[model samples]
Target chain A: MSYRIEELLITTLAPMLEGLEHVAVGAASPIPGAAALLARHRGGGRPRVSMLASRRHASFTDGARELFDCAAQGRIDAFFLGGGQIDGSANINLVGIDGYPASRVRFPGSFGSAFMYFVVPRVILFSLEHSRRVMVPRVDFVSAPGTSPSNVYRPGGPYALVTSRCVFRFDRDRGRFALASVHPGQTLEDIREQTGFDFDVPARIEQTPAPGAQDLVLIRGPVGKDISETYPDFARRVLELDAATA
Target chain B: MTNLETLVEAIHDGASVALAPDYSGCAMAAVRALVRRGARDLRLIAVPQAGFQADMLIGAGCVGSVEAAAITLGEYGFAPRFTDAVKNGRITLRDSTCPAIHAGLQAAEKGVPFMPLRGILGSDLLTHRDDWKVIENPFSPDDAIVALPAIRPDVALFHAASADRHGNVWIGVRRELMLMAHAAHRTLVTVETVVDDDLLADEARAAGTIPALYVSAIAEVREGAWPIGLAGRYPADAAHLAEYARLARTAAGFERYLDEHVRGRASAA
Candidate 1:
């Protein structure tokens, strides 16, 4: 029994690591960044891990405001994003990109996701917290398309959806995604029950791996106190979801 | 102990400082006052390296440009061309800028790890820095890390709405002033009116912000946000901005304006 965040990072994201040529990570995306960096370190140059603000932090070499243009045009290899609002179609809206009333939801505004989604062949999404409010049937807006390849997305759309509960895969043709597998100890019915919309849950799901002690140390070290500071709401979510980012 | 007179005397005699948010608050006025008192040599730092106050400093020959393309802002935000401002004029843009970088000295003085960032990597800025180094994460052998060096200034300057005889100050609404006082090696707090000490203390009490220990000096002066844009506090005087825009189009033009306004004026007196 390992911490949920540790498991999600080490087992789920770690094993998924293939030899991506170059990957772009966006805002609130320290998990994938850490995961990729960890994998390449543990797995040996698996992929060139990068971030949307790589230049800002000092580790990134290719600093482009528009990830889709460069990624679609073969500037980068993969991208990672999160959806505050996702629908059955896999389309996501971080928050309403449309004019906000200033009363309700306040997301930090979309940062070039449209172009990135339409271009990158490999897209991985991780939800810091998963809930019915997050995994909805339809997004409030479309920052990036989730399903494509039918000329709708000339290149591709989201390849995988990593949630707190389960991992999802999309049909390359139909564009509707199905449950790739539920995490270890979780049932397809469990995932279905928690989701906001009806979805095709496969009978088979895999158990996610927990991060080892060494992995946990690495995961928590670079983050410093900034993790809890940045995600103050994590205390509430951690108790509710019974998950940990290690 | 350096009182207001000694500190203002030092600033008047040419001290380098960074002016946060509103044209270093009243450092310009303090500098002018110093000039009237026969003190000289004042340099200051402003963000958006190409803006009007920045131009005026260059015009007055007080500051040339930011020492490095990047200075920390406690909580203000980032300027996209920060790296480009020093790097061969090639600016790569980013997306998240939080307007806190203008409060760099504040965080240093306040003793914080990292302030929030607004815009940095969401633009073409990233493309320009392929030559920049990317290294393995220091703690995580498997992860990567980017090295951001520390930023420290020689002197800090800012203005507040009011100050007491003891040099305790209060700036309404704007927190950028507090940030400047904290970050500089030598600091100056200039104000329009010398108010009651309790009133300034009450203002800080309301905000629950930094104490006066962070500020090194204070001088009473008016029109502190002059020749600089201060939204809602004072008018920016767009005509002045446009005029500065013309003079600051190049380094040579900026130098001439500084010579005429700053050096020439000093020579005349």
Candidate 2:
């Protein structure tokens, strides 16, 4: 069965959420949001998925602070983060480029990444754009560090980084990212050329597996229907599911 | 009955105002009124994050500075006016993380000087915010955490579904509004309707109601959170927002948007 990149991304990310008690997807994250929904659907609703801005999915009654409070209390098992610039050490910069305050370029400032990256046990780093511009040797500003010092009271850190081209697993102890697998049709040289930072590659590199036929059915059917409430444009464009029809 | 203008007039220039994110309740009508009145040099305290409301305020040139975790039009893409203002040195940006902002307001709510939170030790947000301090955890030796100062805005402004004649505002599940009402010196609200029934008289509604004590004033403005709608009451006007996102990309376009939707409508009203 033919699959879109969105389908591939959802299938690839859904398994990472396996056995997680609760997975939260932040704002403007359509792909991860769909993946979480898929994971929940597959798990028979085992992992409670919380997608911010969606009333149906989110169970936070104590308002915006509840998510943070829940994370701080170590209730959230997995979360997703993205960056304007990400370094080899997994330091993600959601703040702007250049100096402090007066930035030459300003991406939207860090939302909950600073706190969530530390509190959530598994933080899957995601950025669709995988070029030197985004994957920098060093981030201009550290919105959230990939890893913290021993005494920082941090239980969570970077787990893996999923990009358009490949996936890289973060070694928290070493403070570096090692290539996990390349997406189908993307070569090792392509990833190496595009990446700004250096990473370790195992002797045998594997291709990222494609979504199964059943995975595509779930994604196009119920998962697409669920995500449309919050991210309509993404569902319509990618899954070809209209809000009315879905 | 209080008028929208009168409620907005209380907000003087240079006043620090607290605003909720788009997903929560937002007073877009009052924001347009502020722009209509040419309010200036305002300091915006976004509870944690902001979107269309903040962008519109910044684009209207009402804001002098913004302190928040983020200001972006989710799904619609980057908040154009905010991005332009930051890059062109039009406004001072005090960057913060989500929990820190919440913590700061929580400190204000508790009448405390500061509140300590975990994480953000290595983030550059620490370097910029002079008020934020990092100290050793007293109880746990050698452990470090960041302390954020209290965020007490002069006024907390938002739109809600309904208000009682007695000034109690029914916010439903958006309890951050209650927090803002508690933390701010004055809480100004614009509601869709002012019901004759006493909100506090009922047990179910009372749970979500912000009492008159915390609410300084309220005016009824139906569909007050237009373009960015109130949850359960209405879904966001995505087409309008997409149009806004498109037009707000350029300075001329933004001004045109202001003229057509904001400035022109204020005069018509």
Candidate 3:
């Protein structure tokens, strides 16, 4: 039941978006786009989803949360984003050169990192490229979350961290990152070996479930229309990868 | 020694402010500062803060209504409050996307009559708003035209990575702080430093960065952009921000938080 990175990202979002009344995505962010589109148009009576392009205002479905006004600042049930440089506390730095704008690296847009972190109830972080350099123990720059001086969101912060191989959540009480679950065909041993720092892993971690027929159908079917906005160019650039038929 | 109180007092009611496009360092801090001074009832001529500041203003009860920054339709996986206002028929607002609102405000701050813009058509966002005026397309008959009025606030607040006591600001990357200063009737600045007047009174720094002339009062607030980065000055306060993210779940919670953290407190630490 091992899924590729793309599959892991899209599929994880399908179920994770289950009970949300509404959600808001950030700008120049891809995973958020996929999540919003899937949640909005997934099931017949699914919940409302909103995708906020960092550049423009927000667009919603039915009565989903708005990004242009107070709704963007409203209580967002959940939030997901990739990390360029993440720390122990789950702070993100998408706009800086090694934590200082004066350094060698710079992300032109911060969009709403601080604002989103200011308002959202649940925060989920995703790092597409899981490497020691990218996924560091301490982030060089803190673009959004002021979770920790080093790493450790004050509390009830950075609910989860979704990497390609495994998923982790912050134990609010203990104030540390812990293993929440794993993707199908992945093990803590494998994920830990890949990770650079020492992390807390739950004893009874389960492999992430496989994408069911509904997930695939949703990913391939009506989901595209809802998402026609995010990848207007990319979606057209590449065709849907047909599941390999053995 | 200008704490949050003096900063807020500077912004009198019924004043004009030139709002920046994003949450710049000093402006962001000044906003919390201004809100503390009972400067509620803000009329946003443009959409700034990428919804972060917008949401803050709304939650703070500062924003009575808005005419800029269209609620990103079908964005962020949820409907926008701007849209909900239209849906539930609660809040009073007009639709204008973030950039348009910023651009219009900038054009106005510069004392320009009007400016040209794109991307609002075909969405019904700006279809029928009394604030926005639809005029004949001077360029062509085939395509009609819409004119965005200038948005000028009572007082403009700006932040810089490095600034002198006289208010010579250095905007690291974007050149928006200048626009906001020019747009507003009065401008306030909070910087990382209040350097010697000799360093601040330089004419060379006036090109991209705002000049001392445009700035009224300048305060040196270290790590002004705590939760957000201030370009070259310092990184965001990641730990503090994450705690805030957890607290920003509901308006009631945020309001309570503002009462305790922002309103209740005299200044932002």
lDDT of 1 by residue, B67-154 (tens): 3222321112222122223233221122211122332333465566433221222222223234222355455554432222223566
Between 1 and 2, whose DockQ is larger? 2
Q: How many backbone clashes does candidate 3 have?
A: 62
**What lDDT score goes with residue B125 in model 2?**
87
Regions of model 3 farther than 4 Å from truth: A1-26, A31-246, B1-3, B14-18, B21-23, B45-49, B70-91, B197-206, B267-269
What local lDDT does model 1 show for residue A85?
78
For each candidate, the alpha-carbon lDDT, in order, equals: 0.50, 0.92, 0.55
Per-residue CA lDDT of model 2 for B4-121, tens digit only, reads 8899999999999999998899999999899999999999999898999899999989999999999989778889999989988999889999989889889999999999999999
Two-chain DockQ for model 1: 0.02
lDDT for A29 in candidate 3 is 54
The 10 consecutive residues of candidate 3 chain A with the worst lDDT sum are A56-65
The best candidate in terms of TM-score:
2
In order, what DockQ does each candidate have? 0.02, 0.85, 0.03
Q: Summing lDDT over every window of 10 consecutive residues in candidate 1 chain A, give the lowest-scoring window.
A: A56-65
Q: Report the lDDT tens digits of candidate 1 across residue range A1-246.
A: 256654455446755666666666664455675566666666566576655323323232211222333554676666777766777777766433223222144343334454455566777777856677888876765655665333232464567788877788766677677887666667766787778876666565566555577766555553322233333234234322212442
